[model samples]
Target: MENQAFQIGKASLLTKQSMGEPKQLTSSIVILVLATNIVYISNMLNLVTYLHDRMHADIASSSTMVTNFVGATCAFALLGGFLSDSYISRFKTMLIFGPIEFLGLASLALQAHLPSLQPPKCDTVNEWNSCKKMSNLDASILYLSLYTVALGEGCLRSSMASFGGDQFDENDPIESQQKSSFFNWYTFDKSLGGLLGLIFIVRIENNKGWDYGFGVSALVILFGLVSVASSFSFYRIQRPRGSPLTRLLQVIVAAFKKRKLSLPENTDDLHQLDIKEETFGMEVLSHASGLEFLDKAAISHGSTGAWSLSTVSQVEETKIIIRMLPIFLSSLSCYICNPLLVIFTVQQGNTMNTKLGKIHISPTSLVIIPLTFQIIFLVLYDSLFTPFARKFIGYRTGITQLQRISVGIISMSLGMCVAALVERKRKRVA
Candidate 1:
């Protein structure tokens, strides 16, 4: 009877553990991510045309507006990351920002549906070239709605990946492996969602109407919010560490304050919050070389306390960010090419035979071709290329992250070169 009671207790404990584990959390979060991407990408795919056709903006003005909108969305992601790390928890950040995005989409849809909110309809036959510019009121409404969506997108981009990661515990070997798998699948899911938006949603916007497309996107985002909320009980929430920017600032200030202080020969002489371990009680990284001046922040001159003194971890954190800046800047080449490609591709598609067999394809929908290729390439790399490379190279891994990034940079440069050549050919023919 005692043994039976013990077994029953064990089973109950196992049941509770299983209940809390991240079995379906990835699926739930992926759905939210998928929905969000669909909303964002669908709008973006046709934004140039929307500005040109509906708002009566000139080509240069429309192109500039689209470029600025894209830039704002990317930049706002940093603000979102700051908010997530500093004041609000990731879950709360998502909950707040998700609604903001939904409202923006709703406002955009309302603007499209209400004729008064739009510019006077262009006369395609006779007055197409002489269309009136969008009035101040219409321009204000359009920009305000776009920026609102950008703000929400920025927040979600910063928070969602980290929030999804928080669901799995790294200490458990099985869960840690699952977390790695989650990242791979999550990326594929996002790409798939973007492809769907480019194909189906853009088609609807072009064939049926703009109002219907925006309305559908708004509804899809609302559904994503519901899906996320449903899985709240299962999510593992991480508390925000005090702002990383503040910590960086504290290190800089402390380092500058003690600029005249002499360098110590022994690294052990440096002040640390925990002497036994480095970086949050984990002995993962040894003290990195270079930026020897920042190390002064960790020097114990006197009992000046927290502002004047910093842990080795804090000083190292700042140094790590400084070291990564170059790599980050290098990656921007790909992003610079993105908007230019979008603008040129749409213009080219307008002049090309866009009919695929029986169906007429929108120029915006051409985005799906690259997206489909990306998905196929990713699948091939994961399933075939990686294993072959690993074996051929006699290494456990196929390629280093930095090497992969370099390859991507080279590929992007080549693509841009090819695009320039194509443009020149088309112009020569014309």
Candidate 2:
């Protein structure tokens, strides 16, 4: 009887664990689908290159216009974050903002067809020259459309990330681990979107027209909206964390009142500490005064390190700066490499193919190759390499975003070196 009871209990535990996997997978799939669509449309390299190559806009000018999209999106992300944390539910936020991205795609398509729709004032010059050399009105409209797209997509990105996280019960260890794994898959799907957009969608756009490319983006956005909507039944709704302002104030107050703040010396003490004290503890009050005094003292000393933060914060900042330096230097090389892919491909299609026996290739197709490699690496590292490294090194095994990002940087650097070698080979042949 005792053995039978134990078996029943074991089976019950196994069933519960098995049930969680589907719940986790469903939520993750929603995130993955949305992530894929977002990346595909946002990083459409051919579209950017098309403007630069055909429009006679210099790299700097074209990049600035592209940067405007990023800026607009970032601003919306801040707004979205505030709303998600305060008044709005993550589900509603995603549902509301996701469709706005489709409007951006529609606007882009309109801008492409605008010249034919509206007769130009300078018909003499415009009729003779290409639309690229036409009046700036078309360009302005095109850019504005892109900015609107960015704003809507940015809000969706912010809300969805939080919403995906909210699906898991954080208190459950197994569920938390499942959620962490979901993020890896989430990133993988996004990379897949970027790869396809770079390789397939961009080529379709370039071959067909800007309108076609924007149309594809509209389709992707629709799919994303559908995926998000379907997950409504699966999602376990969560309350927002409130605004950053409130969180910040809580931190400051907690920091200043350290003396009154009692810590759990033991589990029993935790209960005692939870109870509100009638008066502010004198020791905590003194500690607060000491902190203020330290700030004043550090200010008088005119020290760079002083008056900023405590030792822990300073060390953390130093570590962050150190990590950021390599990425910053690498970013310069990345900027140069990014444009070369499109420029070379487009030039080959237009000029080199005419003179040499070179075949015309789509600019977007070149972007796809690198992103495919990135996706492969992302998965391999997450599923295989990271675990292997952890086992051998006996290091802490878990998601380390910093480490993953550093690996990407290294891969990008190697890619640049290979590109340089390829450039040298082409020059030698020439």
Candidate 3:
């Protein structure tokens, strides 16, 4: 009987182990495909900007579209972060938002050639002067479609990153190492997609047409969706963190009560459940405190421990807002240089090429240079600089995110300066 029991236990363990590997692979692939979409869209921005120039849009008009789109994206990102952390599982959020991104790309492509489907052309002087004459329908559709994409992207971006972080068991050292490796390779893969977009999509636009180029981007996103969906069965669902909002509210109520009670200092007389900050505050703490508060509120119709919830909730809101500020700052700075790169390339293709008497050059083709340089730099940073620093600095202080971020930002600023100088020279020759 003992021998038979041992055999059955071993069989069960083996079956469980066998089933886990496939799921892990599926989850990794899904995240990878999602990351690829970043490069796809970034590259598409270059293509569309190129087309905007081709279509004879004035400088301000062309810049405005990119600025508006980015502004909408930032707005959506904040909302999406809350949704991801509160109600929806990361996988479900992606499933829902990813489709909206697809829809946005579809609209961009469909409306590219059809002027009637889009806002009036931006070529005329003081176009806003005639804004009252044009129906809001076209502008509304354009902004709405763009916003839909922003909404989806905002939700998916951080949730997916957080989800990827969740994939590895921090308790397991081997898997932890694998997780780091996954992120490094993940960033590389995104750059790869960007490179492909710069080469293929840009070439398509230059040779074929703007509509076709954007259509290709839509197709790429569709492929990404398929890749991610295929891996859906493998993902593990993670619950969101605590409800900072509710906690803050409780804290507020508590302050009021403490003020009202004016109870003796250090009053040990009042015993109430204390809430501690945890990973899933909304799921764990808020739910518990909220229920307790509601019960108390029902009976006393007053402060019922709601003060603690209010305070914590307020703190959570502030922290989340603070957390988002950096991303917005970085995104804004990056975007400022983004269109300029494409515009510089277009100038090279037209006037610069004319002066140099070179073979046919397309503005889209120059986009590949930055992407190539980026990949090279990324690898160099990860392999060479990171290790050397770890060996020297890690032995003393250790590698920190702040240091890396500072270095990258300074380097990016320097790169922008060089690009500006290059553009100025190009303009002079033109």
Best by lDDT: 1
Model 1: CA > 4 A from native: 1-23, 169-176, 275-286, 302-307, 387-397
Full ranking by lDDT: 1, 3, 2
The residue-by-residue lDDT of candidate 2 on 1-430, one tens digit each, is: 1111101111231223323343543554465464545444435455556456445555566666655555577689888888877887767777777777788778777766555523332333245354335356756766677776777777777876666665564546656666676667666777677766666567666677766777777777777778667655445555554664543343343334343333333422111111144111101111121223222221111223222222222222233444567777766665555545544544433323332246545544555566677689778877897678768865443446566567667777897788779667767866
Of candidate 3, the 10-residue stretch with the lowest lDDT total is 1-10
Top TM-score hit: 1
Worst 10 residues of 2 by lDDT: 1-10
Q: Per-prediction TM-score, please?
A: 0.88, 0.65, 0.69
lDDT comparison, 1 vs 2, better candidate: 1
Badly placed stretches (over 4 Å) of model 2 are 1-43, 52-60, 117-137, 249-360, 386-402, 409-430
lDDT of 1 at 9: 14
Of candidate 1, the 10-residue stretch with the lowest lDDT total is: 1-10
